[model samples]
Target: MHAGRRFTLTEILVWTRREILVLFGLSLVPTVLYAGLGWHWLGMPWVPIALVGTATAFVVGFKNNATYSRLWEARQVWGSIVNTSRSWAVFVRDWVGSAPPTGPGFLDARQQLIYRHVAWLTALRFQLRESRAWEHMHEPANVEYARNYRIAERETILAEELAPYLTPAEAAYVLGKKNRATHLLALQSQQLKELLDHDHLNNLLHLQLVPLLVNLYEQLGRCERLKNFPYPRQFATLNLLFVRLFAGLVPFGLLPEFEKLGAHFVWLTIPFSMLVAWIFLAMEKAGETAENPFEGGPNDVPITALSRNIEIDLRELLDELTIPAALQAENNILL
Candidate 1:
């Protein structure tokens, strides 16, 4: 996500430059026709158009509110994952050896459990980063802006990334599965079972740990739901249609209103109308970009950076010396 206080005017203009140009043309065309060609008949009553503008504003507001809800929900799910991950680390470290005569596999089991959880995080973010047909990342403006920062999932290989955390056999098994994150959690359950059988973990601790796995499953499923089910397409389509419709009316609406000031003031339609259209258009664009929170856009949840942080925190809990540094944002974007 954008790490700065707010986007610079330059960045906002750069992102919407193409649309602004279109708005300018839309405004300038009618102004030239009415002012130069004496087509004063093109001017329409402003009251009806003002009603359209008000309706468009309500629609845009609804869209922005819905999209922001999706983003906030995604962030909440990730926050849960962060807490669950730390709890998992603590459980594996402290509770796995409750029985006397902790087996030779004690440390190995702890490391395996924690590292595999990290692997699960890696797999999940990669899955979430996968492109969807409805996402705006495929649009030219979003595609161009993405070059300003890196998407770690796009740059790295998932299997190669999962390699460090899983044993050869476990990695192969998980890679073979269709839902890698779900299977990884299943493996965690199975490992807990094996630990219980060997007395490395007692019944009480195993029962507690199993619920943690379930919580992870719930969080993972939450993220998947947001990823798979897009915001209602009908609402999106209508929102865009209404915004464009009002934008088209803006210049004609302003024409007679400006002409009241003076004949020369009719030329004011170009800039004034363009300004109004751009405001609505920019608001629509902002909602569109934020609607999909996991589509690898700059405005998306910084899952890669969040996953790296969870790893660092979990590893340090294990007293490991080789933990990687937390990820920093590039060009004021964290994803």
Candidate 2:
């Protein structure tokens, strides 16, 4: 979602200030220490230092590559969200356009479905980002503004301690279903069909709209995968430990060259060791952050902004007078 301009050095520092500081402590101190040792006691084997440095560069590169892979994959999922949203919009406009006046409440039904679809985009975005504070984004959040709104229903499997006080339910039934999204889809489609049967809409409109419902399901499946799956914690942890171990070994490895550079070699070893460690750790953190795009990290796609955009687009499509402000930006960063 970072567009218009690349981040400034200041902005990068602002976003990653804490992480950078931690990496400096973890990686820089060791490298500088060993660089000094290499200069003073093992100057003859610059060859081996160069090789280790080369291998360190490769490790950093691998980390960068892995982080980018997670980022790109997350973007791909969001891309599908955008396209699917547009698809639903097209169906909505068409569905509403096809109906005549007072035709079995076709107009209301389509609007309900469309507005709910807009909401679906919002909830899906929030759910992915773990920003769904239920009272704020759910309970009253109308996933559907029009007749065919598809809100995600929290499927009820059983009753809780205060379940009986809330509403009427056969507790003995032992299970309940509240599929917000799928239920909306089925409800709207069924309502649309009933209206169509009454000559509320033509075949083409219904046919076109039905497919979008299925598309919504597919997108839901994808989001579920993204929300639950994460990068292997062990691999990342091991690499970090391995990097630290190599840094610790550097001092001993350079003992033979300690004569010429004397104490000055410490300065050289410190920076070298730390620089590589920072790169590795920074990238490892990047992957961890990218692994869950829903967490609202800097690297995450702006799901909140995306939800706002969907709201905007739906409002525009409806030609409503009460369009709200566009998604806010942090100077340049959009949510």
Candidate 3:
């Protein structure tokens, strides 16, 4: 989400301003009390302060490294998603072999299959995000639970994507649940089976499609990984506590050394606490948000936008034009 750029000053201030005020208020009272007790009583301790700073740095560094690992992993999985999508499109085009326009040939078959493929990607994206309602996702994703799925639409799309790719007798090999991609493929395989039954296709087409099934399985694994593998909660909670502790201690450490005799210079502790508190807290909050990249944060990827692009890519193969514009988020923090 941050890409190569660090956060701006404005972003930090806005995110941490409230906590800064609270830290300032909490520290001001102690600073004034300590000052009222005078320099004689308020003996400064630098050792503890140094230890706290060291601890703060260590924790920050460790947590940051772990958080970025998660971000990078999510990005890598999506990269595979992009690659597999292109591969699928290419496979469809080749498999269909350009049925004649008016003679139940390639183009018509390709059109049907491409739309279903695009729809599956869209559904899968929303399902990964948990963004849309369950029922709403069925048609687009093509993998609706039986109770949730409508039969007519599922059959239609299945027939379209597989029609050009599979032979009729091979299509009859369809079995089991009406999964969108699987159903289409099984039917296509049935067509191949039929061709084999009729001496049309040999075992070569079967061999070619086996790898495609393996790739689909890999994509499914990737989807499962993103949805399930969140950062450990205990680690995130501990780091959060550590950041707060660091923020709170900054004032006590500096108040004695920085205090001036003129006026109520003790107030410096408030701003000092505010400043350090803001920096550490903002960083901690940001790190937390980014670790779970799919849950809809300001800095999270625009999955919907990406899905639409996928849809458009698939449709362009058929010359359709109902596609939407690329929506860009301001400040590079896409939701």
Model 2 agreement with the true structure over 199-257: per-residue lDDT tens digits? 77678877877787787788777767666665555655665665655555454444334
TM-score of 2: 0.67
Model 2, position 282, has a per-residue lDDT of 52
lDDT score at residue 27, model 2, on the 0-100 scale: 42
Best by lDDT: 1
**What's the lDDT for residue 167 in model 3?**
43
| lDDT, candidate 3, 78-166, per-residue tens | 66766666666666566644433212433454554554455455444444555323112233112321223122222344445434333
Model 2 bad stretches (over 4 Å) = 1-60, 97-107, 131-179, 250-259
Q: Give Cα distance to truth, residue 49, candidate 3, Å.
A: 2.7
Q: TM-scores for all candidates?
A: 0.97, 0.67, 0.70
What TM-score does candidate 1 get on C-alpha atoms?
Answer: 0.97
User: What is the RMSD of candidate 2?
Assistant: 9.5
Model 3 scores a C-alpha lDDT of 0.56
Lowest summed lDDT across 10 adjacent residues in model 1 is found at 98-107
What's the distance in Å from true for residue 148, model 1? 0.9
